[model samples]
Target: MKENLTDSAYAAGWALVKRLPEPVATRLFDGIADFVWRRRGKSVLRLESNLRRVRPEATDAEITALTRAGMRSYMRYWCESFRMSTWSRERVLASFEPEDVHRLDEAMASGRGAVLALPHMGNWDLAGAWVVVRGMPFTTVAERLKPEKLFDRFVAYREGLGMEVLPLTGGAGTLGKLAQRLRAGGLVCLVGDRDLSASGVPVEFLGEAARMPAGPAALAAQTGAALLPVTLWYDGTPVMKGRVHEEVPAPAEGSKREKVAAMTQAMADVWGEGVRAHPGDWHMLQRFWLADLEPRPEESVLPDPQGVQ
Candidate 1:
């Protein structure tokens, strides 16, 4: 009732993936690289344009290489995520070399809820599975997908990993649930990088401004949760680095708008650097900028982060 789902394609696809052994999955992933790499659809073209817009310094050759790498990473991410159900703790741990996991551990130990603000860079789905394996009580907001079947399947898989999946709408209600978990010293991972409904605050990214959802910053400010920067990448091996940027202090002291703006800007800076570092890893397929859309907002301006709280 909370989130609309799609047809069972995703569920069906994942079911097939789960049935395959690791070695088989790995092989098939590589075998289908050519098909995946072919830029045949509008989605892939839009993805390239987004990448170029973010990293204008990239040459056509570099863009192509990054695109190919992205496809491979995408395939591998799916394989690894489905395989999580069968993977041992040691096997799952092998994929992660947390450059700053201690930051998260320290926060969790203090019994204050911490927010893991993730982006589209690298394998976050894999990262979530890793979190559950490490015994962190994890939860996240997922935007509703059209149709209902697909959403249900995605939630079921996440729940299977011992995570509490919240629909983005009912997500606000789940904040207290997340806060209680945090108050108990647990962790909640939310993707802060996407503008789900184009109703996010604007922040400078790549070479231009892009909108990012205010949910993460708003929740952190509201709940007094520590907002942590988490970036996942392929270091030849999929690795996740969790860095405790300065804690997202509540706007309780300053103009709420100013406080939110500063916090959202900080997140933008971190995500921008990641996109620059691995341009292809950013998976923004939809038409993103306000200019790209047919009708612009009448009162278009940078999002007032403080206003959201």
Candidate 2:
């Protein structure tokens, strides 16, 4: 029963929100963010906790203000997502402003394929859409949302945007499928910041020990693809901004496991820099550090991110 309501809510969001005027929809989502921020719900408090680590020197009042800004940024992501399906190609291209995109071009030109590892700092879906518009349709893995139907909705939505979506679990062969795409000179984008599976490569992130998914690093090492870390953020306008960091190279003379670990740690360091540079745009509103998750080991590990990317 609860699952049905959750699915219906998202269904309504896609159906109705897309039809509203741009300014009206923006104001509506901003209002919703403020309301939730004022309530200081579990999600809000969790965001506060995570932000403290990001800005360790912040005073209480500053943290409070930061959290509110973070909530607004998060709500902006949702607003952009709900209406992305309705966006035209020109709009999609115009909205995303990323630096060093030639890296993607060079990687693909090498015919070894490329893997874009992105943090949940901004609307990654928009970035993906921008890529698709440039004629490079990529494949991505999605963590299955509960109430099965909601997950299906997400898949269809991304597919509609010219992406090939794979399930994170219970797919025909997730790792093999990704490798096949890479060897064919195709692109794969993965959310690298969060580890849905607890068994992940350990790394120090944001000044604490945290586990980050090794898929990006592993895929790059196995297929000889370029491993590029991309961080995104909103720059207080409708335009979304991002950067493509230099690719992480596999360490010389290391076992596959060692190489993966080193690459993942490098990726984590890049992510920490991105988050610090734009803390509010990072939509991390859940437990992230090892110490934070130790006591609540069995809690839901899935991020409250509106889009899995």
Candidate 3:
């Protein structure tokens, strides 16, 4: 019963929200953000805890201000995603231009595949759309959302925008498919900031030990794809701005295991630089650091990402 409602809500989002006028939609989504922030729900609190790691020196008041802004940014991502399907080719290209995109161009031009590893910041869907409209289709992996129908909705949404979507689970030969795409000089994009799997490589992120997915580094290592770290943020404009940092080359001398670890850590280091610079744009709302997984008595009382969190 609940799952059906959940799926219906998303179906309605795509069907209805995309049709809203710009100012009306903006005010509606912004109001929802402020309401959720005031509630300080679990997601909001977790977001606050993560932001604290990004700025440990901030006083309580500062953290509060930052988290509120973060919520606004996060909500902006959702609003943009719901509305992006209505964007035309010109609008897509005009929005969210990256600096140093020629790095990707060079990789694609060389007939070697490129892996675009981005953190969970800004509007990734919009970024993917921008690439697609530029005539460069890419393959990306998505976490399977609950309620099988809901999963299909998301997959269809992305596919409609020219992406080849693969399930992170139950999609057999996932790595093999990615390698094939690379060998064909295609592009693969992965959200590299979170360790959805327990086996992700460990690294120092934002000055704390966090595990990040090793898939991006491993794919690049095995397929000779360029491992490019891309970071995104939003300014006051409708444009989603970002930078494509130089590629993280595999170490010249290391075992297969060691090479992947070193590459993943280097990627993490690049992520730290971006997250620090655009703390509010980062959309991490779940437990991230290894230490956060440990049991603690005070965990229940943690401030949510809303006003108090």
Most accurate candidate by TM-score:
2
lDDT string for model 1 (1-309, tens) is 322222444555576887886678888876565475683365556667777787688799988777677667666666676566766778767767666678787777777778888786666766777788888858776665445566566677778777788776545676667677666666788877767354678877765766877767776776677888777677664454434455555655676666777788788888778777776566565566655665544221111111112
Give per-residue CA lDDT, model 3, range 88-144, as digits (tens). 899999998799999999999999999999988898888899989988999998777
lDDT of each: 0.67, 0.87, 0.85
lDDT of 3: 0.85
Taking the tens digit of each residue's C-alpha lDDT, what string does model 2 give over 32-132? 88998998877788889999999999999999998999989988988888999998999999999999999999999989899999988898889999999
Order the candidates by TM-score, highest first — what do you get?
A: 2, 3, 1
Candidate 2 regions off by >4 Å? 294-309
For every model shown, the clashing-pair count is 6, 0, 8
In angstroms, give how far residue 266 of model 3 lies from its true place.
Answer: 0.5
In model 2, what are the clashing residue pairs, if there are any?
none
* Regions of candidate 1 where Cα sits further than 4 Å from its true position: 1-8, 31-33, 170-172, 196-198, 238-253, 295-309
